[model samples]
Target: MPQRPEELVELLPAANRFLGREAEVGDPTERRGLVLVHDLAGDFDAAHAGALAGAHLLAALPHEVIARFDADSLVDYRAHRPRMTFSGDRYESFTAPEILLYALEDDAGSPFLLLHGTEPDYAWERFVAAVARLVQQLGVTSVVALQAIPMPVPHTRPVTVTAHATRRQLIEPYPVYWGEMRIPGSVSALLELRMGEAGVDALGVAAHVPHYLAQATYPAASLTLVEHLERLTGLHLPTEALREAAEAHRTEVDEQIARSTENVAVVAALEQQYDAFTAAREGTDLLSGGEVPSAEEIGAEFERFLADQDRKKPRD
Candidate 1:
């Protein structure tokens, strides 16, 4: 386990200065829960959206603010290294904050922790293990993890959510869309495994958003995940703001699609592929190796599709 900085060691003592000493609005100790979120690649817009959605959920429910840790304050030592070259030896080092943590008092009076970070130099396994240990120490009852998945689907459609739980019994009411017998590179996957090993209940929800719009628009996926969080945690989130943002994103995409005939055609094709993929997954009880596409393959396909569209466009 990584050693905690002296600053984190004095959390309870620093609580008054950090979280304010005002009386909490609401306290619910019966059904305590915790939520963990991460923007794995540091997609700034996506992270902002996720943060907004999280804030909305927190505001709607009777929960107390516990502790918040900014990722910018957590230093990364792995990025700092001395380099040696044949021509000359030089020291090349860079330092940046690694992870952020937010502790919330849930309606059930349980502590919910939210985590986000920039892409780390080390493997996700190490990070997840450390977080699991922290959760164990905090005695968090249930953990909910959220993420956004960039997909070929159109932004005009409703965002779809896929969920995985450490224990099937914990998520009995919700639909079980997918599971990985072998874990993947996503931090959520590793953390789910660690949570199970530590006897902490954990669930993950991945919101699917149109890949084309992910860079320029992200609030749609954020709102979608927020809705799911409300359902899972029994918390109400004010979606008016997010809904407006999503509608604006839709209008922008509509204008772009109308202006370009090639883009319109490409979108039509993507819609078909999206529908087919969803149907295939829905019809299958189990996932096979052939059903999943590697991240590199997906990226390549997106590039090829965009290139072909560019080639078909009228030259200036």
Candidate 2:
């Protein structure tokens, strides 16, 4: 049987055992009392953005440390299972889920929780129950989940964030807007629900990134979420470095777009759709809906483009 989360934390190997690996622990006595978790899969760029933001916040808070999980420790027995109802290919790998725990130093306010990763392969409800048990063991008062959402917004504009909380009364004081659409089930969503049921405050912040740029790095979106975190948690995080990196990335993207006529044309078409959607949503409390292309649509377009390119390849 898997050990309890508290027991797992105790079992964590010391830094010395990992050689190059080291733990960045803030003042162990200060007690900032917060945790942040994020997913690190699907669209590596977006996942990278969330990870960067989480690392930056941990650095600024003075007493928070990055949560480390032993990915190798997870054991999933269903690795070779078919991917979908009609698919025959098996999954590449499978492992057990890990709960990473970090200690917040410096008497810094309530605990924050962040989660990032691709959709889980197992039961989300069970995952949430496990997280709730872990939270109780960690003595966390609140949890915050952060996610990066690819949208139709332009890269030139500042990324916007939408938030959702289990209890409106707890999060109403913050300058966050409620999510306009229904979010499907995921480990993070299940965690939030379980946290609320356990009487631990929980909220989710989703940072928007331009869909065209989802394949590329977008540190600007990361910085945007960091700013929101500072406001919500009363912790200051330095974003100057992130801003500079984002600007550099934007320049590179612009240069690449300029060089590729096909990409330029696609971007232009996307821009027109974005403009129309934005205009329709302006001057009202109603938030933009259905502006972002679904994952299926993006995948289909990409597959078709790839097929065309393959056809154009020279005969060997």
TM-score of each: 0.63, 0.62
Q: 94, model 2: CA deviation in Å?
A: 17
> Could you tell me which residue pairs clash in candidate 1?
28-108, 28-109, 29-108, 31-108, 34-112, 71-99
Candidate 2: C-alpha RMSD to true structure equals 9.8
In model 2, the runs with Cα more than 4 Å from the true position are 1-47, 58-70, 73-99, 104-127, 170-184, 276-316
| lDDT of candidate 2 over 177-218, digit per residue (tens) | 232444334566677777788777787676776766655568
List the global CA lDDT of all models: 0.55, 0.55
Off by over 4 Å in 1: 1-52, 55-98, 104-112, 117-119, 123-126, 173-184, 273-316
For candidate 2, give the lDDT of residue 240.
82
The top-ranked prediction according to TM-score is: 1
Candidate 1 weakest ten by summed lDDT: 284-293
